[model samples]
Target: MKRNVLLGIAAAALLVSAPSRATQLITEEEAKLPPPKGAVEVQQRGILRGPKVEFVSPGDAASSPLRLVLKFQSYGGAKVDPNSVKVIFLRTPNVDLTPRVKPFVQADGINMQDAELPPGEYTVRVDIKDSDGRPGTAVFTLKVAPK
Candidate 1:
């Protein structure tokens, strides 16, 4: 009878310990996310050449006339109709900025000069549609420095 009682107590202890083993904490590095695909380039531009967008803003937050530049490149020889493409600018969460959207037309490549944006973090989504209107979109993050 004592052996059976000891076995019962051991079983209860094992059950109690099992719950702690199942409650392991997960680290941020263990939940790392994947990077975005495709080739994307964003820069400040003074001239228009191709399907490129330039984001410009005041070097200081206290200044006016903020702008953004966007440059588009086709991957794997996939030609995107500039006229059928659209650009949407969304203010990043927890940031001071305004949201904007604009349509881009193909003219010797996609080029938008003097595109204005505020000084803050932003998420820019570019959508390119095919002749049939099938769409492909790319999202990029842009940081505008204070004037």
Candidate 2:
């Protein structure tokens, strides 16, 4: 009876994961890479000098798990890989290693990341480009106080 129950549980687990098995989840490291060549691209019309990126989260707020969101006021209909958006540290946060995350694009114009960070002074930089390879850059100041 025990063996049968274990087997049934294993089978059910596999069934649940089968649909997502083929789906690819983007890694934080991969998020930093440029989007692939064949991604959907719309014409670059009324292009701004650069991507107008802004932070939606508090610039002075400190939390153990920090949430970062950048909204692009104008992208010229360019496509960016949602997974490719990241909060790159100019210098290490308190932790020796940077946090890993799977970033996604929200329905709004924000690219967001939830990062578990150590308490320290931090300057984070975000670099992103449009499908046509036009680049946008933004910097933010964040201070994490140790709890």
Candidate 3:
């Protein structure tokens, strides 16, 4: 009787400790998916001009100033609002950056001047967005030297 009780207890323990193999519930019919939305489109234009080095010193070493010139093409699409477009610059290493809004006078081009950068390698990222909220981005590397 003792052996039978021990065997029964072992069997009960095995049943209690057995791993559960549950299946994930799913409907027989396929799930309904939403239709795809229209994609956002953005374009960048123009050429950037600067020295091989990132820094420029026009006067005495102690008083020389640093300048960064950035240029790009304007959006050609009629749907894009030139006044609403904005350019953002992100500095690398130090991670200091700023944002500049393009003026409406020049709807087809961008020429920006930045003088607040310190000596280091900076990652310049340009973003253009249309009136409809579509956005495009371009990234470039700039190296600034000591004045």
Candidate 4:
């Protein structure tokens, strides 16, 4: 009986913390800036070339399982199919794409990826190119908090 009560309390705490953690990512001041044009706004890396990408959902944290959905704009203000927009994620901490992450695709209107990574400090490099062969690179860092 005591174990059941503790479990219920823990579950309730999780439910309350999840949404707040997500919302805490974006602030009103950052939203005031003009949105990126025809490129991936790699958070702190500034703007680089590629189909424009907007985070449908805010926040990109290093959790056990990371879910990300990116909406793309046509390259250079022209129509470019998502297929033509190649996107890959390279593990930056180590000079390889191996044992840590898997690449994903943007089939429809959005680029969605779900990556399950071990808990550690790491950086991921985003490599992208358009149909016309314009290339762009941006680096994103993830520090996984220990459980």
Q: Against the unseen true structure, what C-alpha lDDT does each candidate score?
A: 0.42, 0.51, 0.38, 0.44
lDDT of 4 at 130: 60
Model 1 TM? 0.38
Query: What are the models' TM-scores?
Result: 0.38, 0.50, 0.37, 0.43
Q: Would you list the rank order by TM-score, best first?
A: 2, 4, 1, 3
Backbone-clash count (model 1): 31
CA deviation > 4 Å runs, candidate 3: 1-67, 74-80, 86-106, 131-133
Candidate 1 vs candidate 3, TM-score winner: 1
List the pairs of residues colliding in candidate 2: 31-84
Residue-by-residue lDDT tens digits, candidate 3, 1-147: 999999999999999999643221111121122212332222335542211111122222221123334333333433434554444333212221323223211334343333433444434444554544555455554444565
What range of 10 consecutive residues in model 2 has the weakest lDDT sum? Answer: 92-101
Q: Write the residue-wise lDDT of candidate 1 on 1-147 in tens digits.
A: 999999999999998877431111111232232323543554434542223332332232422133334444543434556566565543222221112223324522333333443455445566565444445555556554555
Among all candidates shown, the one with the greatest TM-score: 2
Residue 8 lDDT in model 2?
100
lDDT of 2 by residue, 106-147 (tens): 423453345455565555566555566666666656565565
**Where's the lowest-lDDT run of ten residues in candidate 3?**
23-32
Model 3 earns a TM-score of 0.37
Backbone clashes for every candidate come to 31, 1, 3, 0
